[model samples]
Target: MKLVSYKLKQKPSTLRVGFVMDDKIIDVQEAFLQLPGHSTEMEYMLPSEPNAFYKIGIPAIEKAKKAYTYVMENQVEEISFHRDEVYVATPIPEPSKIICVGKNYAEHAAEMKSEVPDYPVLFAKFANALVGPEDQIVKNSKTNKLDYEVELTVIIGKEASNVTQEDALNYVAGYTIGNDGSARDLQKRTPQWLQGKSLDNSTPVGPWIVTADEVGDPSNLDIHSRVNGELRQSSNTSKLIFDIPYLISFISSLMTLKPGDMILTGTPDGVGFALNPPQFLKGGDKVQLEIEKIGRMENEVIEGEFHY
Candidate 1:
């Protein structure tokens, strides 16, 4: 099942959760109310927040699946909400942690001229960096160089610590696409990339989350990016130096991976910085990141610095 955090266009400022079946978006809350067994307790049980929704685990998935199936088979008219009628938010809008891997792709490692490490290189982005797919990526006036890294993001389904690589897949809630936007100048300024990598509104995640079962093999999928309609990065997850299972095991060993937490598997090569003479983003540049079987996330760069 594909799950999404969204709100109706009429209530763009509010957040709701849903999933897509085609061009239509089935609002989970609304669908649940229409389901046969729904009650006051069931209403209370339904997760309205994206992060809280995943806490219930597979049962929530099962509920959505049953509701969606019922809606399709019996309550077709009730789906008055269309995909165009709602705004999609970052799938895990307030995930407790947004951990990311760097240079996990071999070609990416070679492009950056960095050694392929035996271990996964991890970094983080807080809630400030997270934005919905449709949100504008702000270009700060502090520096000129901005870049995009397309990555396959994993969302943890349960609490885990020191999980074995062989059983790592069991802990995954699902998958989504992530655009690891960076401030190139700030990143190169220091050894620790936090400043450049975690700028406000820098990360664009979603369209929606595709449940792990549907994605099957996360390590082998087509991933690509297009900046302003021009193809920039095109590679497969098969090129990943440290695949999902290993990364999950490694990361969980260091800290507990909680439900709704995210792990960005890392970007493939072809980042703007590695190009001949380099290419950086400017205001109005549109970026599109696509991962096979998941979906495409498109966002545009907006001019000027962000202010509180």
Candidate 2:
């Protein structure tokens, strides 16, 4: 099942959670209300926010699955919205921690001229950097070397601490696409990459999350990125130096992994910075990313500095 967080055009401020079925988004809360057994308490089970939605744990997934199945089999039309009628937000709009792994792909590590680490290299982005499929990535005047990193993002489903790599996948809610937008100049200027990595509204995170059960064996999917329709990166998750399970186990040993937290599994070779003449994103350039089975997301790059 494809899970989404969206806002209706008529109620722009109100966030709603739903499931995608045949390109139509079925509102989970509304679907619940349509069911005969639904109670006022069911409303609490389905929050408008994705972060809280996951905090409910396995029952959240089960309820969403039931609603999605019911909507499909019963032809429930009133609660479903067409793709263009709603604003799609990031699957986890306010992730507690957006943990990013650097140099996870061997080719990407080579292009950056960095040694392959025996341990995972992790960094972070905050909620401020998160944007949805409908948003624009602002290219500020302060940074001249903007780059894109397309990664297979893992969304944690439940609280996990000191779990084994073998048992790590059990904690995953699903997968989504993440564009790790970076300010190359700012990144290279300091040993710590926080300034370059977490620019506000720079990263575009989701079209929606494809539930883990629906996306089995994520270790070998095709992943690619295009800038202005020109393919810049083409690779596979099979190339990941530190796979999802290991990363979860390694990170969980140090910090608790909670529901709605994200892990960006790093990008492949062919970033703009590695080009002979770097091709940083400019105003109006569209960055398109696709990971097989998870779907695609495109965002426009707007010129000028962001205010506030």
Candidate 3:
């Protein structure tokens, strides 16, 4: 099931499961309102917590499905919503911390002239960096070299600590596309990449979260980035030196991972920095990050004045 957080006309945003029926998004909440005993279930399921969807939302959806199935059999009022009319928010909009893996791909490591760590090289982006699909990524003049890194993001489902590689997948709730937008100049000035990576609204995260069951074998998908309709980074998760399970276990050993915490599995080669005359993102540029099965995320780059 493809789950999304969205806002409908004049309504506050809420978590919803999306289904493509007749090429329109089936508004699960709207359909649920028309069902008997759904109100109670919705109240119990719908919460601000990221893990609530798995704990309560899925079960509620299952119950609603039976009602929806019956309604379909009887041909009740058609439930459909136009895609453009709805506003999509991040699947887990307010993650506690966005943990990212650096140099997980050998080619990416080589391009940056860094040694591939035997263990995962972890960094973090605060919640302020998070943005959803269709959101604008501001390009401030303070940083001249803006780059994009397309990565597979893992959303944690349960609280985990000291997890083994074998049991790591169990804690993952779903997967989403992450663009680790970087300020190349600032990133290179310091050994730590935090300042360059954690800029406000730098992380363009989600269109939807494809459940782990739906996106089996996370390392086998294609991940790529396109700037202004031109493909720049094209590679597969198979090229990742450290796969998802190892990443989760490695990080979990250092710190506990709670629901809503995201782990960016790292980007592939072909970043603008690797180019001879390095093509960096400028104002008015559009970036598209696509991960197979998880869908694509597009964002516009707007020029902004530097502050501080």
Candidate 4:
């Protein structure tokens, strides 16, 4: 199932939770209401936001599946909307923590002139940096060297602490595409990288989240990036220095991972800053990222003021 957080284009003020079926989006709450035996109590069970939907666990997913099945079988059109009728937002807009991995690809580490790390190199991004696929990636005044890193982001399904590598994938809800926007100049200025990595509205996260069942093998998938129609990065997830299971176990050992928490499993090579002449994103540059099973994100870099 491809779960989405969206808003009707005409009613953009309120956020809605839904799932993609063919080219149409099915409103979860609306569809659930149409179910033959749905009760008032069940109405409260469904959430209007993706974050809350994920927190409800398998029961919520089961209810959504039932709703989709019933709606499709009975040919319900009142609860369905065309893809263009709604604005798709980040699958988890306000993840509790946006934990990111750095230098998880050997080639990426080599290009940056950094050694391959023995452990997963971790960092964090706050909600302020989050942006949907339709939003522009802001080129703020803080730095001139804006760069892009395309990463396959994992969304946690349940609370996990001290989980083993074997059971790690069970805690993952789905996968989505993420562009870790970085201000290269500011990143190198200090030993810590949080300042450059968390610029407001810079990280373009998702169009939707493809459930883990659909994305069978996350470790062996194609990943790529392009800047204004020109391909810049192309690599496979097979080269990940720390695979998904290892990363989950490693990260969970440090702190608890809750539902809707994001884990960006590092970017592959061919980033803007690693080019021979060091190409960096400028105003009006369009950035696109794609992962095999997940979907693509096309975002433009625009000269904009930071929203305080």
**Best prediction by lDDT:** 4
Error of 2 at 156 (Å): 0.2
> TM-score of each candidate?
0.95, 0.96, 0.86, 0.96
Q: After best superposition, candidate 3 residue 167: deviation in angstroms?
A: 1.6
The TM-score obtained by model 3 is: 0.86
C-alpha local distance difference test of each model? 0.86, 0.89, 0.78, 0.89
Candidate 3: tens digits of C-alpha lDDT, residues 283-304: 8899999999988889988778
RMSD of 2: 1.5
Q: What does candidate 4's lDDT look like per residue over 1-308, in tens digits? A: 88888888886357878988899999998898898766888455588677778776556767787887888889898888999998988778788889999999999999999999999999999989999988889999988999999999998888899999999999988899999999999999999999999999889998888878889889999999999999999999999999999999999999999888899999999998999899999888999999998978899898877563
How many clashing pairs does model 3 include? 0
Clashes of each: 0, 0, 0, 0
Greater TM-score among 1 and 2 belongs to 2
Candidate 1 clash pair list: none
CA lDDT of 35 in candidate 3?
Answer: 66
**Residue 31 alpha-carbon offset, candidate 2, angstroms:** 1.3
Q: By how many angstroms RMSD does model 4 differ from the true structure?
A: 1.5
